[model samples]
Target: MKLAILPGLSLDEDELEITYILASGPGGQNVNKVATAAQLRFNAAGSPALSERIRVRVLELAGTRATRDGEIVITGRRFRSQQRNREDVIERLAELLREAAHRPAFRVATRPGRAARQRRLDGKAHRSGVKKNRKVRADD
Candidate 1:
């Protein structure tokens, strides 16, 4: 099965490796015994499905979740059940991939307008005058 992460990016089910571990938090006695936490690992760099640009972007967007070896590790423990946790992890991975699929908006470089600069300078001058007026006069 292939997961459609975005319009341009789709991930194969074979590329993902899933593991389950004991979850911590509110589930009472069942939490300690059941391995409900789901961890999904995907090697973004080695994937044949990703382009070089998307791979780099995915690695960048993955942040702390990504390993040095280019594997993205997503953990889900919000749900008490293993099935829900597994779905959560997969959804999280898809979200991350979706974020990486989009190109960042280019920031337009702009200098302050003449009026803005003037207003800033005027405010500074007004503040300076106010501070100057607060000082004790030598005559007083």
Candidate 2:
């Protein structure tokens, strides 16, 4: 069950480790008795399918969801059924991978223009004048 994450990237099913855990939610009698939540773990660092750059980005995008061991852990407990929860986790993983696939636009370094700098200084001077005027003159 390979997952097609982005246009050119796909992840093999073997790359994912999925487990079912008991969910803490209202699901009648089945909630306490059955494990319906799905926990999906993926090794982003060790994944052969991901390029080095994408792997690093994936780890960065994962934030707290990523463990120190470079594993991405995602939990899905929205649904009462294990199948649905599993699908939900998989969907979340795909969405995350898709986000990692896109490269950010490079930011061109810029400096404040002379006119803009002059305007800022002018505003500061005007503010200083207003504040100075607000003070009662000792001579007056």
Candidate 3:
């Protein structure tokens, strides 16, 4: 599988690992028998593979996804089958990697377009006219 690399120097699969746990609630007969819930474990600090820049960024992004030990844990149990849960975990991990892959475009200074500025001024003027019309005249 192509490992997912996220914004931080950390790659999803390299830093993150998953374990299948028994799912809780409902499912009656099937609940006890199947271990379908997926638990993903990722450590933001401990990884040797991540670049210093990316690791810190990934940690910030992980937020609540992170643990005190710098581990980011995510769990999913919506699927009844273990395979689907695994796929979900993989998809989520991939998403994180996809996020990491791109450097956000920096904003270059720009001036408003003449047409857009004109439209904005026109809209504000129109709004003022509408409000003016709605006002009650004390003389009336």
Give the per-residue lDDT digits (tens) of candidate 3, residues 88-138.
876775566455445689999999999999999999999999999999999
lDDT of each: 0.93, 0.95, 0.74
TM-score on alpha carbons, each prediction: 0.79, 0.81, 0.65
What would you estimate as the lDDT of candidate 2?
A: 0.95
RMSD to the true structure for each prediction, in A, is 2.5, 2.3, 4.5
- TM-score for predicted model 2 compared with the true structure: 0.81
Any runs in candidate 2 off by more than 4 Å, and if so which?
67-69, 138-140
List ranges where model 1 is wrong by over 4 Å. 125-140
Task: Give the lDDT of residue 66 in candidate 1.
Answer: 96
TM-score of decoy 1: 0.79
How many pairs of residues collide in each model? 0, 0, 4
Q: List the residue pairs that clash in candidate 3.
A: 6-100, 7-100, 8-54, 9-54
Q: How far is 107's C-alpha from truth in model 1 (Å)?
A: 1.7
Of 1 and 2, the candidate ahead on lDDT is: 2
